[model samples]
Target: MNNFQQTARVGLFFILGLALTWVTFETLRGGKVFKDQGYNLIAGFTTLKELKDGDEVRMAGVKIGEVERTRLAGRRAEAVLRIDHRVRIKSDAAATIVMAGLIGTNYISIDLGTDAAPDLPDGAEIKTQATADLNSVMSQIGDLGKKLETAIGDLSGALSGGKDGKTGIIAKVDLLITENRENIGKATANLQEITAKVNKGEGTLGRLINDPKLHDELVTTLDEIKKGAGEAKNFIANAQKIVDQVKAGQGAIGALVFDQKAGEDVKASIANLRAVSDKIARGEGTLGKLLSDESLFRDAQSIMKKADRALDGLDDTGPITAVGVVYQGLF
Candidate 1:
């Protein structure tokens, strides 16, 4: 019976040892004893940000794989991701080291690439993009705080004074106010007096504001001026229309100014008038001879004298004798 008890105790101890050994193995191997049936993808980053083996690899927040291992390859750190055979990652899928939370572990997060993109092959390098981690953000915030502190210090110094015994803006402004106090008071008094006069209808501005008759006259004058301006605008528009018509060959002036055929005709008429004037001046035509010949004028005067003699003879003779007398006189 003692031998039986010893054997039972040994068996129990052996079982416990096996259990302990199994738990330790599972912990070290990330709760998986058998190798994962998946392809490997290399993801490179400048810094992994505490990412390690067995960290989850997720595509759009869904777990698709695990980071099989991490290592340094030359200048950059890399993680070998074991993606499930059932899941396919596109060639354009980018990997980023994302923090689960402020206190939680880091993981590899991927984006869903375009559907038309080809699938990534085994052992291919997955593209990695840098992200602003909490540490970097905190560092930038600290820098901003320092800059703000510096700016505040400068503003305070400028407003109060420098340490070099020079007067500050506030002090200088106060001194200026003290020196100009009397002048400022005089200006303010003048302004108040003017405003009082204006309110009481004592000046032009006062009348313009307080006297209804004057206001009506001013409005009438403004209306007249507006009417005159409208008339001027209409005049200008009509003038512009006339000018446009001239440019477009649409009226008599337009034809004379813009029509090539009409202008050519005008030039030809002027040339013909010049030629006729030249001929007249040179006594080449019958009208020019009548105007220029002295002989023609003398002949006309002689004929007038002979006709006068014949008329004088007819007054002194009988009808038959008068005819003979007029013929002899005219001849």
Candidate 2:
């Protein structure tokens, strides 16, 4: 019976030792006893962003593998992923480091590539993309906060009109009001006077404002002006129509201006007129000589004087005697 008890105690101790060994192995191996028997894929990135080995490799939020190791390759860092053999990753699959939470661990996340793409081979290099680090995000937020604070301070300063200069909006407005105070007072007085006049129905403007009949008359005048504008528009349209017809070679003026034969004829007539004008200027024609000759003018004046003396003698003499006398005078 004692031998049996000792044997049972030895068996219990062996089982306890085996359980402790399993627990330690599970802890060291990230809860998986058998090292992930799968294909390895390489992913390179500028930064790992706190991604460590044994971290989950997820596809669409489902754990599909684990990050096997991380090592520096030349200037860049590379992560080796052990993907489950059952899960087929396409060659175009991209891997990126993702934070589980704001203060949580980081992991490898992958997008499910299209099925049309070929399956990636073992030991293939998967594409990697860098994500914004928490530190960088915090730094950018601090910078943006500072800029916003500056803008708010500037706005407050502008509204309060800081005494630095006349650059603030409130300061400029106050300066303008101070300079125009007298003008503003005059304007206010004028407005009050105009209001009194309007109430009493004084001037044409006041009457128009106070009396419906005058308002109606003004409306009628405005309607007449509108009618006149319409008539002017119609006149302009008619003029435009005429211009368009001329442009289209549809009118007599258009034909004279656009037709080659009519233009040639006009040119020939102009040439003839120019030639005649030139001849006249040079005293080449009868009319030209009549206008230009001084001898003809003197002869005309002498003839007129002789004719007057003959006519005067004729008035006092008999017809035959007058004729003889005129003949004797001419000779």
Superposition error at 144 for model 2 (Å): 2.4
In order of appearance, the predictions have TM-scores of 0.70, 0.63
> Per-residue lDDT of 199-219 in model 1, one digit per residue for the tens?
999999999999999999999
Question: In model 1, which regions exceed 4 Å deviation?
Answer: 1-36, 152-161, 164-167, 258-268, 271-331
lDDT of 2 by residue, 16-68 (tens): 99999998977666546756668889999998878888899999999998888
Lowest-lDDT window of 10 residues in candidate 1? Answer: 27-36
RMSD in angstroms, all models?
7.4, 11.4
Best by lDDT: 1
Alpha-carbon local distance difference test for all models: 0.90, 0.88
- Which ranges of candidate 2 are over 4 A from the true structure? 1-37, 60-63, 72-75, 112-118, 152-183, 196-202, 266-331
